[model samples]
Target: MLQASFGSQHPSSDARKVADWALRSHDNRQAAFIIIDKRAARLYVLDEAGRLRGSTSVLLGAAHGDDTVPGIGQRAISEVRPGERTTPAGRFLAERGHNGRGEDVVWVDYDAGVSIHRVLTSNPGERRLARLASPVLADKRISYGCINVPVAFYETYIRPMFARQPAMVYVLPEVKSVDEVFAMAASPQR
Candidate 1:
């Protein structure tokens, strides 16, 4: 039940950079999410909105490769890879839940079985899961194919975004053309 107001000012270095860019570019009138490919990361938050509020970073699926499933769109690096690791590109939704640590998380259910939850750091192997780890996990990639945000950010901004129900989480391969992806997502699934 943590609110967005709690950590509105303490965005991560990456999140702060994205917010600054977005605010200057968009004038903070709309809500936006940024995907950082080179870093295999993502940022979610409400724009300026007359005041800064809510933010978090996520581990993405692997970059494109031969093992990527075609028609499923570009794979993000943080997604599960059968036995490796990978994330997928396309539109998605963020639900809510608690991780093993019992921290509130935004459950981004994208590719089947893939979800973004709080960093679950209970063991050694789990620690090396992703590049970004909290003081707790410090090294685990627990997601199957979804983005994971720190508990603090998730509760502050993400939770409220979905309060109205059905919040959209768009995943693009890069900053390239998103028309095709959006069009396909809007069209009925055949």
Candidate 2:
């Protein structure tokens, strides 16, 4: 296990410590859901038994920001904008699915246009494809506010979490408070 130290001045120090502890002790045996830390770039999958099944690397949003709806006649808002490669930190749900131009993908309703999906890498010339598959991307923040993963990996492992019930995907900039995220999840529209 990794350990991080925060000075007392941190705004959410207590919350961060608690979240860190939860992450460490998460038993994936019957987790049914997961919460990915953008900064950590780690995928924590819990099985039906709630034991920590294991962790894997993932590619995340290259640009980070709040998800917003675009006004009519305006440029469509992108969940991830170029050069802002930081994924938003919050709690979200895997609420839907989409035909990602032919690739199968599970859509995570981050409420910010950001969703976790299969990494698009059909083109040989795309440099991002290599990065998307790198182990380095797993434990660090990357992507445009969306979690990207190997298509087969998602189909084999992560998809089951959303089978009978909607699964939660909590993304955080760093280990911080979960109150806001939990509140959002408990909201009526969620």
Using lDDT, give the best candidate's number: 2
- Which candidate wins on TM-score? 2
Instruction: List per-prediction Cα lDDT, in the order shown.
Output: 0.45, 0.52
Report the C-alpha lDDT of model 1 over 37-121, residue by residue, as the tens digit: 2133545455333243444455544333212354342444444355444455444555566554575555554334345565445
Error of model 2, residue 20, in angstroms: 8.3
Q: Candidate 1 — which residues are off by over 4 angstroms?
A: 1-40, 47-52, 62-84, 97-107, 128-130, 133-142, 174-179, 184-190
Model 2's lDDT to the true fold?
A: 0.52
Candidates' TM-scores?
0.51, 0.62
